[model samples]
Target: MNSAVTTLWEEAGFPEQTVIQRAVSDPLLAGQSVVGIAPTGSGKTLAYGIPVLTRLVPNLGPQLLIIVPAQELAIQIRDVLTPLAHRLNLGVLGLIGSANRQRQIDRLKGKPAVIVATLGRLADLIDERKLRLVDIKTVIVDEFDSFETEDITTIRHMRQDGLLAGANLGLFSATRNDDDIAAFREFWPDLQVFDEIKTDDTRGPVTHYLLDRQFEGKVQFLERLGREKHQRVFVFFNHKHIMQKVAGSLRFTHVPYSLLATDGRQVQRAEALGDFRRGRTNLLLTTDVAARGLDVADVTAVVNFELPNNITTYIHRTGRTGRMGESGTVYNMGNDHDLRDLRHLLGDSVTLVAEKPLVKKREQDDETNDENTPSTDSHDRARTRPASDKMPARKPTAAKSHNKRKQRWRNKKNVGKHW
Candidate 1:
């Protein structure tokens, strides 16, 4: 590592290199196309950032290009590396969407040594001839799985177009299944794989609680949790509508909270994130837009108002809480179906909290009680006679004798009249 980069790392107060950081630093610095897999908040940015910075040649027109899934992530990586890049007298720029295009074009004239960009905006700038990747020597794809097919195609196209013909590619993510591994293999035939994803050890130990509750109950519980816990909390919802609904509920309960989603304005998103980071707000309600690549510190707990539909998303959601060897809790509010899916996905990692069972369980219990209790017909039969034996015949009253005598006299008179 360069002395300047080492000084920056020490100045940042990091005790030592993390497992992933230590494992990949040498290989990345050696210009190998590497794929690093580790849990979230495992110092991935620094792992690649330091190596890229150490090899940066100032005034060499963007030798490093780092692409992330979202604009927030791009800005985050830029913010983390900008100081270190400056220490080495290297220019760094973060290009994202929803910003002034002309301003980005203006910054491009300065020829940054490192460019962190979101996929869409970067592609747009490249198409418009405002940015060029011809000089890029290292192409690092952070959160590689989050990139869509089109984004991957664009990057592949760039490489095929000879823009990054000789550049080293670094792909990093927290969660990668067999399919992801296969795709990586296809992308880079000889890609060096550095995986440190120990299910038990990665991201420390996160205590997961499966709260079986509906939407309304989940909202009520969140209000109570916010009032009682009073710690940094991230309430995650799978949908924007649910996040908005939760935000409204929190507001109705007078809980100090901020809303974050993909559709939010750039300024609003930044303000919400900033407020939460600065301790201005204790709770942040967000969708999956903030699920991956978000590095908020001291997130004491994460509440999943709506459980993610997939295992990968669930991993990322829970990952937000227990980070960097810090102990944290994940409260998941889901129905029976969601719980079943979670159980299938996470196995025993999630502790089933018999907290408020869903309506299904209550219905089942009611059915069981009904089976134990006697019905109306059964009660009547039991009161009347034993149901096991035959039913007794009915007996006539004394009025039958008088009616029989009167009917005989009337029949004799009618027979004589007819003759």
Candidate 2:
């Protein structure tokens, strides 16, 4: 066992490594730049942590750097790594976009053994000379696909500053988005690729449940599931307002729920997550920002009050469940469009029942759908297409010219022969 891993983790319900983990510490990645693609909850952290903590010196001037996507995740990672670091006697410094600015700055001065943070804040500190990556031998970019889009500029600057030379890079994400992976070649050309989840796991792929309703029924259904009190539950919504709204609605039903919004001060978010872990709350309602990199126990279900906007967000949302070899169900609800997105993510995981979709109560839809749907003229009615009509459009075929038709006849006698 690695020295940094704590004994306390045994009681914390550490699932046996999936087939992926068994093969991950393969000979290739011992100290090499690498990218990993594994199913959600397959213990990607430990896969990298074993190498990082085993290599970096403890209680030094920030020898390790782990970049994540959100502040909630920073605290969560801190919670998991701190105890391990403690076992190794390492001080972990977090440079997230959350509470305690001066305090975080102060912590940076001490130069904790590890610095886990968001990219933007980390770059700002580097420019300020508040932190140095010169000693950073091991660097990890978690949820790497996330950094491909909106975060391209900042990440590029960080790499340019000195990531290529001394740092051993690790990029991890549930989404293998080929474009994003292709972009990483510029940064680390020698990245070794390994996917262990393909054949090892006996458990089947993820299971998706799409509720046919305008999202309201799904909330009621989730409340009922909470009544069963199966175990820890993560509920995701697309918008912060919708998250709060669902939280409020769940509260009205008097189900014990914890709300984690992106708008609150980073401390409140941290506290909310801590409370959820401590069993103070069973139902955790959150936005996509907190969807990834959160390790919680006994999460039996993930409820999507409002289906995610894209396949990537859907993956992150459902990933909160069915992690670490424990299977969980995902409840997705919303308009037909939402169901469509769910199908894309579900692929072959969920079974689509031919049962009738929850009918739109005209009066209720007039209340909710009216806000989202643009107003149209009463004289011209809307033409409703079947939910199956979302395929890409095909190009129109052109009529063959007379000369081209004659040439085709000439080619018919000379099949497989080119001029």
Clashing pairs in 2: none
Candidate 2 per-residue lDDT over residues 296-345, each given as its tens digit: 76677777787766767776667767665677776676678767766776
Off by over 4 Å in 2: 1-17, 26-29, 148-150, 200-206, 344-350, 353-419
For this target, which candidate reaches the highest lDDT against the unseen true structure? 1
**What are the TM-scores, per candidate, against the unseen true structure?**
0.81, 0.75
- Report the CA-based lDDT of candidate 2 relative to the real structure: 0.69
Worst 10 residues of 1 by lDDT: 351-360
Residues 1-419, candidate 1, lDDT per residue (tens digit)? 66766786785567688888888888878888888888888888998888778888988888999988887788788899888888888999999897888998999899899999988898899889889888888899999887776667778888777888878889999877555546645656667888888732536566777787888888877777666544888888777876777777677667778788887788998999998888888888887766469888888888878877787887777777778778888887888888878778777656645444223577788888899976667557657775577556567667998898889998776652310
Report RMSD (Å) for each prediction in the order shown: 17.5, 20.6
Would you list the clashing residue pairs of candidate 1?
none
